[model samples]
Target: MAQPTVTDIRAYVLRGGGADYHDQQGTHWIDDHIATPMSRYPEYRESRRSFGLNVLGTLVVVVEASDGSTGFAVTTGGEPAAWIVERHLSRFVLGAPVTALERIWDQMYSATLFYGRKGLVLNAISGVDLALWDLLGAVRQEPVHEMIGGAVRDEQRFYATGARPDLAVRMGFLGGKLPLHHGPAEGAEGLAANLALLADMRAAAGPDAWLAYDCWMSLDTDYALRLARGAAEHGLRWIEEPLPPDDYWGYQKLRKALPPGTLLTTGEHEATRWGFRMLAEMGCADILQPDVGWCGGLSELLRITAIADAHGLLVVPHGSSVYSYHFAVTRHNSPFSEFLMMAPAADEVVPMFHPQLLDEPVPTDGRLSVSTLDKPGFGVRLDPGLPLHRPYPR
Candidate 1:
């Protein structure tokens, strides 16, 4: 039988809550009282609440097969990514075999070379690649994990990323990663506050539960070292992404400067295998946290995982919900998954992609059963009730 080809590719920009739901609001790095690097801007400094910069609207990609079957995936690229998919990427996708995911990914990456090696272009490719995986899984009548080599473990453990580490501990999570509310720009007082917060969380989380800080790439080498040293007394599992992803030299310095046994992790914003190769070669981090949706999808992430495994590094992908969950359950290197608290207060469990995706699964007591993902593809379906706008409308 002839292979089923991709008939059409479409990108939809999804935003705003539907009739029954209000727009989801959440806090960000800049929202903290401390003076962040973003505070340098008059608009941000004068009224931080007004800056809705962290509100990354969603971009949904749909790939249709010749058999009338369709698959879709979502990421935080919004209108710009929609444009990339509609204008630049559709050519590479249309009429391609549903199983030709790697080829399609390579073509998209190469076609956008001049303007798109990373960032939004990669995000677009990642979304499309994920959609292709979903399509193939549906066509094969199997789940994504099976298609990727089946489950390495029957159950997957998870850590919670939110304001309430104590709450996470109560929920039976293995660990809790709190966002750093202060940056270097806040000076000594800010540093003190940051340490104090960690200290409080450590106390609340107790002695056995793991505790970590996500600096969100806002700190300098000096700031990170100071934070790590301060956090050491509290038993910080690791300091994550203190500096920018591109600063390999800084990462090396930070790793060297860290107190003994303190680990460094990054790559949530990094893309592709080459970027992760730099992370491994430079000895930049003890762990790599690549978001599969942002890091060239599952195809490229498998390669990234191999590199991390070879280098003796842990691959705890940044919070991509189910996309990471599927990959995590199948990789030995990815021992735990990250669940970003989407609840308004960050105190309760809620679907990570709430309102946008239906049939999405959330961890029960900080652990997810791989059996829940037995459904074909990524095991989540888009909410048809939610409006999806095609900005480019090809």
Candidate 2:
């Protein structure tokens, strides 16, 4: 047998696209789209699509060898995720064993216990962990999930989010998710308007369909309670991030208060399995929404989902089904995925979805399946030599 050779662990950073920067960043008048980052350049047009904002920040890692075999992986999306990858993960992951991905994750996660753990540390690990997976797959000539454990399904269900009432119809999602924007007043009227939006989406999506919404960490406990009650009336599958991620009691309390089956979904900003375990212990959310890019990548996500399952909860990842899309399909229980409601308009600044995805099959009848990924490593790549980042200080 011939020995497999690895050349170097490479890194790249993708920031906002320049052409769409104005639309992706400058606009704040709109509700949920403001201040939030884009993931890729816009591939198509929709009514609510921002004219300016673009994909915010993502990190891609390539593991290369002498034979031209390559492994590629990316951090899930979040504001500080890039810094985590550059400052911490790159240094720790220089010479890891491709066969022991989970072991390396355990060592790195615990190594930063004194100085880092939850937020930034985990975000960095998320990116590097992904790279390790890519390397493992490419080195051994196997799909990532196949090495760890075979996938649970071929395709995963997804909901058409971020699209407008009219355009959402055409996108063909199994369900629909919308942002619950702060409304005209802080009292009953505001509550009424929020409920009205859910109603409108429900009507637009039709009675047989499912609906969900997020507070985007903007609502208070009292408001979250009111909104959850309203959501019950509309038969929502869940109400996501009803309050800030920090409010553990709020999540738990809301979970208890809401009518059965109207779920409390959160953890998009949490850092590790510890935070999610806390939520799981208290019985907070019915659906634990972990962002792979933010929570320390696949390593932590696997741990987090295990905890969610132990507590008899479901996992609904937060994204347009790129990283999480593939991951969720591998899990027998990843029930749903998210779509952005509105995004940065600029093509140059915010990275948008790949144009090929527009034609891929969406979850039409309330189900999502993983698409086939035959390419080596993590199975996705980025344009070379663009958005050059400063060399990793490590």
Candidate 3:
């Protein structure tokens, strides 16, 4: 039988009640820190939710094959991604052989160079790339991991990221990484408060459970050093994204200054193999955390992981849910995955994407069974009930 060709590429902007799951005042990364613009001013921080700041929106990409088999994926991009998909990327996808994803990705990346080498364009590209992988998996009647290289591990253990580490411990998570709630702008008092919170979580999580801090790209070198130093006594496994992602020199310095056993991790906001190359070459971090959704999807993540592996660095992807789960289980470097506690109170293991996706898998006892993801493609379907908007209607 002849291979199926992509007949159409369609992008949808999904927005509505369930879209803004992270929009709550305390839910955002910035809200945890007082120095960020969103939290700097009392009025803004207090009224963020009421001001309509919590917009849970995403861009969903669907690739339809000549044989009517459809594969789809979603990313954090909103209306802008929809425009790029419909106006610019569609040409690279439509009528192309589903097996030519590598060529298609290169064409799309090269063609968008004038306007995009990173950020939103890459996000849009990521959505499309993932959809292609899903399409190929469905067409070949194989899971994505099997299509790529097959599993390296039978199941994936996970660490919970949220307000409660004690609860995570009770639930059997490997560890808990808390969002740091202070920054340099808050001065010494804030720094003290930051350590106090970690200490509390440490006491609750006990000595053996892995405890880490997610600085959320809000701290300077000095602030991060102080926190890491303070956290060491409490048994911090690592400190993540303390400095801005672009501050390579800062990262190098921070890595050097940190305690010998303390690990520095970044790359959740970084993109592509080239960007990660900088991190590995400079010795900027001990672990690399690339979000498959944001770091050019699984296609690029495979490249990024290879680069990290060559350097003996770990590639624990940020909270990309199942997108990261499939890849994590297949690689030795990605020993554990991150499960963002998306329940309104951060108390339950609800689907990370919530109402936007159906049949989405959630970790049980802080681990996910590999067998659950054996279904063709990524194994989750877009919830049709969630209204999809085509912003740039053709």
Candidate 4:
């Protein structure tokens, strides 16, 4: 059979919630009092959105093939991402073969080197790359996990990231990761509050629940060490993203300084294989958490996983919903996945990227059977009637 070639690529931007999971309204726990780099300024400390965390909405990319199959994906990067896709990246994708993911990715990356290496540009590249994978899966009539390799296990398990680890435990997750509510700038009182919350959560979750804290790049080396020591007494499993993603030296220092048995993890904001290579080779983290949507998509994630596997590190990708789920199932190094609790009070289960995707699967009892993803591509569809705006016209 002749291979299908890419005929067109389209990019659209959506406001509110979608792939931009942070773009939520009215008291979502994710934005409330979570420790962030901006926490140093008391004004932005109360809410991440206060510092424009949700300003960049969702970027939706659609790739159409000559065989009449279209595959789409959503990521964080609103109008600017759409503009990059249509004005620049689309040239690399427009005439490529459907299976030329690597070449297309390389072209996009190499061409944008002067302006793109991480952050928004990589987000745009990741969206395009993911849409290509979805397109390939549609053409092959296989799920993305199957495209990569078959699942190592029958089902995928999850640990929830939320305000209520106690509720998540009842919901059947292996454990719960709580957001670190205070940063270094908050001082001793804030540190005490953070430890108190962890103790309370541990009390509610009881012993045996794997409790962890996601600091979200908001702490200094000294504060991270102090928090790890304080949290260790409460049975903290790991401290995630304690410092900014680029602080490999700090990571190396903090990882060694952490209380024995408490793991230091980072990299939800890191991108590409080269970046992950630095994490692994430098012993910067015990686990790697790359968000497939923002970390160069599946094409780059495969390489990232290989680097992790070689270094004997676990590749627990940061939550990007199905994009993470599909990739997680196929990797032996990935024993479980992270699910972000979208429920406002963290009391119920809801789709992580609500209202944007139709048929997006949620874990039943904190587990998703591989069968839930048996449908072609990522096995999720976007609502055709969604109010998506095409910000950049080709």
lDDT of 1: 0.84
Q: Which TM-score value belongs to model 1?
A: 0.94
* TM-score for candidate 3, residues paired by index: 0.94
lDDT of 3 by residue, 1-394 (tens): 6789999888888664333344443454324333333444555443445434445368889999998889999887788888998999999998899999888989999999899888889989999999999998889878898888889888899999887888888899988888777777767898899889889988888989989888777788988898999889999999999888899999999999998779999998899999999999999999999988888888999999999999999999988777888899999998889988876556777888877878888988998999999988998888877778878865
Ranked by TM-score from best down, the candidates are: 4, 1, 3, 2
lDDT of each: 0.84, 0.61, 0.84, 0.93
Screening candidate 1 with a backbone cut-off below 3 angstroms (N, C-alpha, C), the clashing residue pairs are none
Instruction: Please write out the lDDT profile of model 4 over residues 1-394, one tens digit for every residue.
Output: 6789999999999988778888888988898899999999999999999999999999999999999999999999999999999999999998788999989999999999999999999999999999999999999999999999888899999999999999999999998999999988889999999999999999999899999999999989999999999889999999999998999999998998889899988889999999999999999999999999999999999999999999999999999999989999988899999999988888998999888999999999999999999999999999988998998889
Worst 10 residues of 2 by lDDT: 39-48
Candidate 1, residues 1-394, lDDT tens digits: the string is 7889999989998775311112344553224443334644545643334565435578899988998888999887888888999998999999999988888988999999899888888998999999999998888778899989888997888888877889999998987888777676667887899889988988888998889988767788988898999889999999999888899999987898799978899998999999999999899999999988889999999999999999999999988877888899989898888888767566888888888888988999888999999998998899988777887978
Clashing residue pairs found in predicted model 4: none
How would you encode candidate 2's per-residue C-alpha lDDT over 117-144 as one tens digit per residue?
7665665676667777777677777766
Tell me the spans in candidate 1 whose CA falls farther than 4 Å from its real position. Answer: 16-23, 26-36, 39-52
- Per-model TM-score on C-alpha atoms: 0.94, 0.80, 0.94, 0.99
Cα misplacement distance, residue 346 of candidate 3 (Å): 1.5
Candidate 3 local distance difference test against the native: 0.84
Q: Who wins the lDDT comparison? A: 4
lDDT of 3 at 143: 86
Local lDDT at 43 for model 2: 28
